[model samples]
Target chain A: MSFLPQLAFVLILGVAGYILSKRIKFLRRNIFLGKAETRNDHTDDRWKTMALVAFGQQKMFKRIIPALLHLLIYVGFVVINLEVLEFILDGILGTHRLFAPFLGGVYTAAMNMFEFLAVAVLFSCVVFLTRRYVTKVERFQKPEMKGWPALDATLILVIEIILMIAVLTMNATDQILAERGADHYLALGPLFFSGLIRPLFEGMSLEALHFIERFAWWFHIVGILAFAVYVTYSKHLHIFLAFPNTWYSNLKPKGEMVNMPEVTNEVNMMLGIPTEAASNPSAEIGRFGAKDINDLSWINVMNAYSCTECGRCTSECPANLTGKKLSPRKIMMDVRDRAEEVGKSIDAGGPGLEDGKSLLGDYITKEELNACTSCNACVEACPVNIDPLSIILQMRRYVAMEESGTPAQWNAMFQNMETSFSPWKFSPSDRFNWAEKVKEEEM
Target chain B: MSENYKVPTMAEMAGKGETPEVLFWVGCAGSFDERYKAVTQAFVKILNKVGVSFAVLGPEEACTGDPARRAGNEFLFQMQAVANIQVMNGYEVKKVVTACPHCFNTIKNEYPALGGNYEVIHHSQFLQQLINEGKVTLKGGGEFKGKKITFHDSCYLGRANNVYEAPREVIKALDVELVEMKRCKTKGLCCGAGGAQMFKEPEPGKKDINVERTEEALATGATTIAVGCPFCLTMMTDGVKNKEREADVKVYDLAEMIAKDMGI
Candidate 1:
């Protein structure tokens, strides 16, 4: 019987691991579908950024209430998972409380800590779910968040609450079995949170208690494995991506835009200066900017995947506030959706690059791309450092260069800039005409 | 205009075998916009009164290509930037000062990567330094003493560059009660003229961003609205005009207010 249980545990764990690995591989391939760029500079700053932004949740504290509750769940989720190691060991060895003898007092202490965290996690999830459903935070109710995004957030919270409950139930039953002097059970002091609910299992027979304990144990591990797999498909992927995302976040002055080396080289050649060695000399130059996901840089694609869909960017966007079609959060979501669509199509033996539609017309509209002010508000407001403006600018570049779809007035100004080196339709010699006017005013 | 106050150009200064302490970058708006020309003159008067040796690029100075770049015309932007950079490099220009946030941002942040490096200072920061160094003195605040003056932050100058306090300190020196709009500093709203919006008509919308921002300024009940950027000056002026508040509320650049306070 023990052998059969061990075999079942191995098979289940193996299947979950295999499926999760496959999903992760698919996601990795999808994110790397874009052009390559190096983001590995500034090693010390990257580590510090990852620590403070992702690990320490530094940016989340800008709004204090949500930050506190999030911190509770974050700490609970990370710390409680430490108990999973013992579960795996118990399953594989068919031994109960496998670490009890070795850890002694430490085992009880750890159990107490885990129980406390489990209760906190459960409490935090309930509050989070209530906030999403009842309070309807304005950021959560935007038009883009009306359907699956809303359901995804609620579902994650429910899963967390269920997992925490399972943990507490397992602890509660384990305490009852200890009291009954069940075989292979050790007497440890009552776990802090589980001790309170242990009375519900009072006067239960040893067989009944063991059965309940075994069910809860198996359910907790299985639920965790399932949650692990579900995370890759959910916005909660931020849990894993946030570190690298924040690490690779733009560190330059907010006003300093990324200059295209191709443009620089062309300018240098036109100016009769020796051009720098081009990265891909023979590559097509007509595609000035991104029209599809593959045209974007790898970091841009990674940004799409790392988005938490929290709508904080949209909430802070001036364009969105002033009734423009542009929503920075929506830009990220659309990119991820397009990438996923492409990934699935390729997996289904369809031509990947031959997809009829693109991220430009299919997902985001020209009206939305043109509406951005490039003010960096959305960039500043993003807790995870997603650069929606970068994507917007790239699409705008496509519109301007490839399609020649810029507004007519902008074209006139571009002509002015080309001729007089100013946005005004005047000669460069008249640039200092105002200085003479200043003298006239003084007279 | 005093003929005694000679504004030397880089070419004229070079012909005389001289290099001034700074190159005054008079941007397109400062050079052409009728109302903003006063701001340019006011800033020049302050520099003259302070006895700072500065030369203007005059006709040789091109636009910093900020608008072109923001409008996604990279080829035009690079061409303009390279032309200006070449001219500046020819004169061996070491330091530059501009009253325009657009120019300041481009020169200070964007120019170096393309190989044009200079110690670029905005007029507000430079004026504050002049005041601190006992070069420019206010005549007992003159018309500005105890006046409720509110400052409108240009997005480029404030959020983009993290320059929040320098302009405020310049205003505080005039002994005026500097009030703040609801969205000031890092959270300040755009003046509806950034990102090349000044050159084109606004998108179809129920309200203008500048009108909304100006309403916030009007709500503060400030008698004078001080701006640091010429783009903000134009937008806020239009905004005030739109609300028919022109008779009650007036907008002036910080340099204008300072020049007035100093009786320059």
Candidate 2:
């Protein structure tokens, strides 16, 4: 009968692991759906970026209050998970507090530390919940955050609170069971926070106490497993993706937009410049710019998945502040949504990219793309270096190059640039007319 | 203006088998915009005062293709880029200085792939360098002294290229009180002229971006709104006009301020 519980624990873990791996594979496939672009140069610099931006959470300090609150949760999330290893071993072996007898005083100290972090996580989650629901922080209340995004954020916080409660409940009951000399419950020193809550379980029967301890332990571990699987589907994926995303961040000057080598080759041909000796005459030409998820670079798609919906990009956007239709946060969310849609359809053996819908027209509108000033404010504001402007520029390229659908004013400017080498119709011969004014001042 | 303040062309110098130390890339705005022409002249005046050998491209110069590239017309952008590269490479042009952030950014960062590479410096950074070298001397408490001035960060120069301190340093050299906008440096608001927005009307919005940015600048209570790019010069100038604060609040580029401070 004891073996039956171990078997059940093993089975549950196996199922959770299987589901988590499947979801990870799905994400990898979807991310690779984008065109390949090299981001591996400067390996040393990439590592430093990952360390400072992702691991160190350096950019979060831009807003001091939230940075402090978020640091508590981030540190607590990492530190508390160290206790999960013991939980896993205990469940597999059908032993309670597996490390208590082996490590002696160290086990008590570790539990105390974990308990401290659990309380901190709980406190931070409550403050965050209030900030989201009560105060309604402006960034969290944007239009893109109205539906499932809002619900997902609330669900993560609520789930975290319940998990923290489960940890404390289990600790308190186990402490009571140990004091009562129950089997398999080691008498570790008091966990300060959970000790305060031991009064609730003090009057229970030994058997009942044991059962409640077992129940809370199972709930805490199982909830963690479920949460791990759920993160892949939520904006909470930033918990995992932020590292890789920052590692591959664009390192060039923010003013430098990506150049099109294909366009360079075409222009070279047009200008009668000698092509590279290795240039192939029969090379296939790809679409000019991003029209769908597949058209963007893999890093761009990963950027979409890595978005935490903080709405920092949108809040900082000049266009968004001026009441324009361009919300950079919405652009990222749309790309992620379209990616999910395409990934699921392909998984179900349905038509994928041929679904006759695209990220450009169906998900994001031309008006949104047109409203971007390409100012890089959104890029600067992203904590994880998400480049919504790059996606905006790519879609603009599709509208201009593929559809030739730039606005009338832009078309006029383009014509002027072509005919007179200026956005206006001024003659090149008169380029130095301003100098005449300087000479007249001299006279 | 001194008779020595002559803007020599690259062709004029190249015809005599001579090359200036730096090629002054007079961007389309600097060459044509009536308001920005003064900026071009002021920078020229400072360069002359510093005794820097600089030459303009004159009739041979073409657009740096920044607007077309930002507007998503890559074909046109590259055509212009290739044409300009051919002309510059023919002259063995090695160093370039420009007053426009857009042109500076495009030529410095984007042109290398198209076989055009030159040491490019924005006029703000160049001005700061001149000040550092003790070449461009400033009078104590010159025209801008005791008057409050706020330097607006052009997007291309500030966030794009991370040239935040140069313009501010140049302004500080005039012995003026430099007040910063609430949003300055990395967090500075755009003047709404980047990405070819200067060439087209903005999409329908509750307010124009420049007016919104100008409100922040005005809130600083600075009498002079200093700028670094010609696009910023036009946008902020119009913004001051929109608020009808033109008489009380004047917008000048960094070069113009230096020129005034030096009595050039």
Candidate 3:
């Protein structure tokens, strides 16, 4: 096949994919992390985190052996993709068969290597499917998927299964045909598929099987590329987007609490947990932080995108598991669903967050935010390293600093800390009593 | 080369004429809040046994503002931080030691951001050094040979500052049979007492975090539970008592355990 036509198809599709991504408005905001110290920025210590977390997928399989199965499937898919080009070139121009005519042995050897890789990938996907269904790792086992998203995941699995099987069948046919010819010592086609098609082709002569080869070649090449485009817009976009997201992670401060904007007009500002972001939209209008999804800083929204939906954050969250209102899964899904629902409006590119339905107003609650232990287990579990602690801290700051709305326990703790310089409600002057013990020891 | 050790907090020096080589900054929990005050004082007692003289920074010492900062009140944290810095600068003290892991981590990692630069050491590390230097005798804890004991890694001490070995070394030196909780080091579960949750009541749950951990210790069939942080000891003891599992496990601070064996 001449390089011109396939190259043209690639460029056209690439542009369409790029433009459609924008039109669909799926990706929003780059460098979308907060201006804080995150581990990603401190790459000097952990260069491997980039590879392991970003590529090796340390986050996907929380469980060891099952995760390994998932890893094999993940790696297999990535490794075999390079072969699609050769299949395309062979199909369009009929210039290359299983091997190059000019350099028969070398070309045939390369095909043999790639053919084996394809087989491995096929086996991997089958095991991964089995793991997803049978001995399912709960994190990957999402039964709650509804509407198009649910269907999309299934379609993806089906496509991969079909591609792998077709490649195997085609390669089998090639191996059988190779046995007939001396130059065919290298190509292993005329494979398992050849026998099935053989009787039919034999009735029409080997010429018909040659015709069958042309169809298989075309089918594998075009089908994979279209699938690639489909993935760009699909939930599976993490296959590509996750790496870049992890690289540019927030790398925010480990313990620095988010500062709430202080209130100067103490009297006019609502006194207790200003649950709403009073919107007078004027330049100096006082509002609670994060009125809506768009109101969330670019990094927070990026967190929603950066999520692999691994469920690590949600699964470990004490609030969610204990049957509380919050689930990091629900939180992220809420953002994703809300974003897709309001895409065109956002694409209109008017004021962001100023207009959309408020995120906190609709989904989150004071109890849910307060229930967080700030334990950072969710942060630790996240493969991409998004920090739920930071978000909770921000909301906490809004409640304490701006609204001064805290439960009586917090009120009492503060009173104790203020008087005694400690929160234990103990005598302040006794702060140094331990020193007497140290002195007695010396004597 | 790093000169990363804590400088004496101002509260340590009052009318004291000269700078001291080490300023022991006993945290509130170590001083007035818990009986574990002996951890720092007895540690100094041991240091004196090794002929290492240290100054105590008592009255001038105040909260490290960890509670306020963690509870999301930045203004209160800054206020306490400013006051603590002033007390430290007044002393011209050089080195600081604190028994509390919370104070150690906040002083070592966070204080510099607000301009409180100090060289800080946890007494556990300092005491271990004293032992290594042959400054103090390890005459402590009558051989706890038959009793299996579990060690709880304090969050701030182990994960925050990466000081995993000192307390464990102390336990090993006692010749006690050591049993480790499933989650001992970095992966150790929080005692449900961090983020200033200690002073504040916990959200209602079926069981307290401390009791949950105490049950973990009892499951190991350990007769005693040892802890480095005073907060952990207090909470875990309460947890054991609450579960009525105190008969199975007695919680002790590494300091009290060592002092008993040292015959101090």
Q: Which is the leading candidate under DockQ?
A: 2
Compose the digit string of candidate 2's lDDT tens values, residues B56-114.
99888889999888888889899999999999999899999999999999999999988
lDDT of 1 at A54: 88
TM-score winner between 1 and 3, please give it. 1
Where does model 2 exceed 4 Å of error?
Answer: A277-279
Tens-digit lDDT string for candidate 1 (B63-124): 89998888888888888888899999999999999999989999999989888999998898
Residue A384 in model 1: shift from native, Å? 1.3
Which residue runs of candidate 1 sit more than 4 Å off their true CA positions? A203-205, A276-283, A440-443, B1-4
**Model 1 - which docking category?**
medium
Which ten-residue region of model 1 chain A has the weakest summed lDDT? Answer: A275-284
Task: For candidate 3, write residues A1-443 as lDDT tens digits.
Answer: 46775665566557656765763345553223222334345675355665778787776555676477566657657656656655555544434563366656666555556556566666666776675568776656443345665567667777887886667556554444454452323353323323444454344334444555545655676677677777755667667656655665544334344434343122113333232233332356334444345445555655666565667776665445444455566566655555554554555785444454645545555566666655555766777766556556665655676677756787787777788887778777777655544443324
Q: Pick the candidate with the highest lDDT.
A: 2
Write model 3 residue lDDT over B1-264, tens digit each, in one string. Answer: 322212232333344555667777777787776557656655655555455546666666778888777776766666666677666766665677777878887777776765568888877787677667766566544756556888888777775567779888877767788888876775566676776777666665455666666777778888888887778878888888887876756888776666666765
Scored against the true structure, residue A431 in model 3 reaches a CA lDDT of 72
Evaluate candidate 2 and give its CAPRI docking class based on DockQ: medium
True lDDT of residue A130, candidate 1: 79
Give fnat for candidates 1, 2 and onward, in order. 0.54, 0.70, 0.27
